[model samples]
Target: MKDNKQSEKDSSADNVDEYLQTLGNEDARERRYYSQEQPFSADEMTRLVNEERLNALLAQSDAFLSSLNSEIKDFNDEC
Candidate 1:
């Protein structure tokens, strides 16, 4: 019975490890793909890079705004 339990635990751990490894591989592939996608024009590439950065920044800003709004609501309730 103890051996069966240990085998099950080992199997679960292996599955989790495999999932993490798959994610790592996917990230690496994405990095390689992005790195190779050089636009025909320098300006175009610059624009594309800037757009990605802007989108990431916007997402961060949205998250911050949501947190701030939540905090303000909490403060208002306390008052």
Candidate 2:
């Protein structure tokens, strides 16, 4: 059972790596700022918004993990 959970975690990590790679590729595209400002099509704008939300969520998650680590360290020290 523990091995299954470990494997699932590993797979999720791999998926995250792949997603980051894909995002990097997408972000590398050149923007045509000087051209006529075309309103962002719905799908593209939605994706951008979702990515922004995802980044915010990730930041919160990192902060939460850091807090947990500090609490665990303090607990261990008190033992």
State which candidate has the highest TM-score: 1
Predicted structure 1, TM vs. truth: 0.51
The C-alpha stretches of model 1 lying farther than 4 A from their native spots are 41-79
Steric collisions counted per model: 0, 0
Candidate 1 C-alpha lDDT tens digits along 1-79: 9999999999999999999999999999999999998647987777667787789999999999999999999999999
| lDDT assessment of candidate 1 | 0.94
On lDDT, the candidate that comes out on top is 1
lDDT of 1 at 28: 100
- Residue-level lDDT of model 2, residues 1-79, one tens digit each, is 9999999999999999999998877665434343547788989887778787789999999999999999999999999
lDDT of 1 at 16: 100
Give TM-scores for every candidate, taking all chains together and pairing residue i with residue i.
Answer: 0.51, 0.39
Our model 2 lands, by Cα RMSD against the true structure, at 20.8
